[model samples]
Target chain A: MEVEGMPPARLREPAHRVSPRAVRYWTVNALLGNVLAWAVMFVIAWFLPEGRWWSTTLVWLFVVAMLANVVEVVVEPVVRYRRTRWEVRDGRVFVQTGWLSRDQRIAPLSRVQTVDTHRGAVMRLYRLANITVTTASAAGPITIPCLDTDLAEAVTAELARITGQTRGDAT
Target chain B: MLLLTPVRTLGSFAVPLVLAVLGVRRGRDEDPWWLLVVVAGAALAVVFGVVSWAVTRYRFTDEQVQLRSGVLSRRVTTAPLDRVRSVDIEAPPLHRVLGLAKVKVGTGVDATRLELDGVSAAQATDLRTYLLARSRVAGGDGEGAPAPVDAPGRGGTSYLGPAQPETELARIDWGWLRYAPFSLSSLVVVAGVFGVLAQFGDELPIDQIDVAQDAWRWVVAQALLALVGAVVLVVVVGWVVVSTVTYVLTWWNLRVVREGRGNLRITRGLLTTHSQTVERAKVRGALMGEPFLLRLVRGAELSAIATGVGTGGRTRVLPPAPRSVVVQVGHELLEEHGPLTMAMVGHGPRARRRIHVRHQWGTLLVTGALAVPTYLLQDLWVLGRLPDWGPPGLLVVLGLVNALVAESAWRNLGHGLTDRHLVVQTGTFMRTREVLERAGIIGWRIEQGFFQRRLGLADLMATTAAGSEVLTAPDIPLDLAVQLAGRATPGMLDDFLV
Candidate 1:
């Protein structure tokens, strides 16, 4: 809350939590992917020689993986949706997300390279869009997924405008 | 004046000659006609070199230098003189003998865009002076003359040096010679010398040589008492000698100076001289690389990350120096003292626990992966089987070492924040501390892997346009990461509630 022209303690703006559709979006994405992987593991385990040390280890691993997937594909998405949030201010962008390891990221509006919006099949069905904010980082772009389409568009336009103002200006 | 340069022809021939010699190596019954192949390769190389030299043509325009060169496909390169960041002239021993030099014109964005190899010394100097003058004039901030033109009648119209008033900042100190052996360069030199000697081992005539024979005899006699001790002593002595020689050759008479418009002009070399001008405006920050051995001796090297400046050797701003001197030089170059002098804030207990866990898990996984396979495969091989307890004992030792290193690494993890800069301290062996201006940070990345997420930890990376382009703070709590990112560039995260 050290933004320019703002008081230090006043106006503690709460983060905008992502829409609930994100939970459904991520849960389906995770379950479909993990189920297929788990099936392959189970098939491999079934074909293993019985009562051997390696086979027994495989069985134990498969069981652990199943439990892990249950948490990851089902319970994790809800917590993740609750955690995912983004906020736009006068000259910066702040995003926070993560269920187990929470990440809070802030990008100065001056350094914003580009703001892109996209809608996949699932997102389109849910009338949602994902806004990806790209900076000059090789780690990849910052994506805010499963926001309402209108909100996503508004954020994109606002970011583009802010970045345009600060473009080519030295710090 | 427009004739092909002889040095270019020799350079082109070198690769083919080496390949031809390698192909015609001493013993190969199947290749009795190797001489024919070698001759053909050399002839081909000569033809290609001649053609390339003949085709290449360059001319100086009013605002740009355009070079066209290609035998089949016409490749034209246009370098704007005003944008020229550096004009480096290099003359190896052979080129020096022939009074020729290689000129490299760098714009800093694309690094070197034009290289005029094997030009006469006079031409190289003229080009360097003409290009550098225009670049300095363009960068002069409206304080100097607009531009200086080269007169056709005069042979050497302008002095072929830095285009502005210069002041020497630092030069090679003989006292710093002791620090050379501790650098990685010494290890490289030792390794290279060993490789060459090993390659010619059969031709060495060791028994025929009196000194070598005496040395061997001494080694053998010493080995009777303690073989390992004798070998270790020889290695240590050899390492010191090789390292010192390498350091002297590379850093002899090194000079760093200030050029026009906040540009640093560095010139250093033993046999082949190198000069480069670095614009400080493009510099994001400076990093101090302190290797384990160097740190123990309280020594470090400084490098700055600037746009278009390649990392590693290219970014080096200061040679190996004591901590106090390096810090002073760094502060002077950067013109900021806050970030360099700020006290660092350490990570929490959870971060330490995470590091410990990671080390433990890594040790377990590696031992489990390697030891089991080795044991199982040992019985299949005819060689002697390892003792049953060996793998577990080795694993325990490795685990202890890993634990110790993990604790040290966790202790080293810290970050410092000033009003206009952020400093991140990291590294396990080669400890690197980077001081970057907050204004240079373009964006931030927050990453949380599954295990890290489970521990409520995250890594926040500040993305910039200079150096390796990313400065990361790993294993910090989510709340702290938020606060840190906000504090790093104050106006950026005002609306975010952590």
Candidate 2:
């Protein structure tokens, strides 16, 4: 099928890439949260009766979580950043990104209910913003995580324009 | 000012009042002040009702309907008349007895904007009719393009207007009563029976009688062969009586009529009267649903995929009827040639294989999960509770049943695209054949899971702003799925593909 040649590269690269600094911001924030949680678990483990089933379980959990957090915070963010892509044109918005399974969603601007951007403190520090486009579909919002603030604004403006152009008929 | 404010207020407190009275009667011997307590509660209720009545206010403007209420934290809401998609009125037995009804105004955006709890029945009807007429005018001008005012009496034109003469489209026929026992509505009746028993259970000496224990003894006393037959008989008899009663209550006096140019008005219910008006313009297509049991009687349910109804998928344009009746209604509603009653395009052998694998695996996965617990707790552990060989025998029976179901589902799976519309049919227990207009489709989604990809299968979904939102044709070949997506809305796949 002609579609065979249409996927993978263009699907992920046609849209503006999210800020590269997103990986560092996400990893640092995730590591901090994991350390804080581990501290609480350590305190609980100190009070637990020595050599009990729960104590051993907690010790194993702490070790496994520490490793998992390192991989999740350090590795996953970089992979996700590379995979994420979004574009808005004409009467449609396209997003292609997923952790394991490649989920490509094309939401018509006519179905879009809201378009908003968010910048958390960490993201703000990294000069990055996230744009979320919500359609009336029950599949939930289509989000473009960690883009340059100016690009996010441009995307939002373009979306608004498309939404206006495609308005009236569907409703 | 609403005339039924007092009645509406009383309706709010009726449930609590009944419970309070029941509690007082039950505690009469224990507490001498029980009657006094009930009287005091009633007095407080009256005071609250009066306060609420004084605060509540509602009015209609040229473009919007405004409502205000609440004693301390006042909330004022305005709903644009044009945005209003449906105006539904319902009256429970209590409201019917008092000649009052509840009015719910919905704008497809929000679930329900305004609900006037108590209004005189005649007032409810008048309000509904007025709102519907106004809504039709608003919707026609809503798109900023003047809707073409086609001449009425044209065979194919769907329009809404004040001058359009009212004509009865369909009404409830008791001849379809035979199909009631085969409907899922019977399950609702069974649930209602349980609900009634649970509500009055404490006063009924149910615990003292130990019905469960008695039933167990009876089952033990009966021969195994006799037990199966008796159980089947009881279940079938109970199902028939319950379903018949439920069907009557839900569909009693049901009627559908074309009142205005593009408005279809439906009035139904026995114990709880329901009146709903849906704009014909918003109707994208019709879906004919036939559950496993209903299939035996050749009865099908017809529901409209219309916008602004806020019903999601429960938008029934016609009740369960024979295949011919449902098809006729479908044709009349869409004003197109029998889209709902089409000869479907069947899938290839590969599609059948994919469906069989999909259905069989789903059933086996569930059965395997159940069997694992039975093996661990009963067989391996020798709990002696389950009869020997019972669990394994049940597993075998389930496997056979699942195979038949998978085969049935595979046989039913098909999709066809015509010049004006697309028809997709699938399902095992709940067979649904949806017919959607080609133009109503707004977008497309193509999905292929791990197993599906391996099987060279893809699920294609046609997304529309209205109706079910997404109509999917599952387990079709990847190439065909792509073709269907392209055909659903031309050039939609081109941008994404390149």
User: Candidate 1 on B187-278: residue-level lDDT in tens?
Assistant: 77667666765576566444554555677867755654574465456667889888787777667778877765566767777877666665
Give the C-alpha miss distance for residue B331 in model 2, angstroms.
2.3
Query: What is residue B497's positional error in candidate 1, in angstroms?
Result: 4.4
| Colliding pairs, model 1 | A100-B453, A101-B453
lDDT of 1: 0.72
User: What's the true lDDT of residue B8 in model 1?
Assistant: 55
The weakest ten consecutive residues by lDDT in model 1 chain B span: B1-10
lDDT of each: 0.72, 0.73
Alpha carbon lDDT of residue A61, candidate 2? 85
lDDT of 2 by residue, B341-425 (tens): 6677666777778776765676677666666556555545544355646656766777688778878887888888777788999
Per-model TM-score versus the true fold: 0.76, 0.79
lDDT of 1 at B99: 75
User: Clash pairs of candidate 2?
Assistant: B159-B261, B159-B262, B160-B261, B160-B262, B161-B261
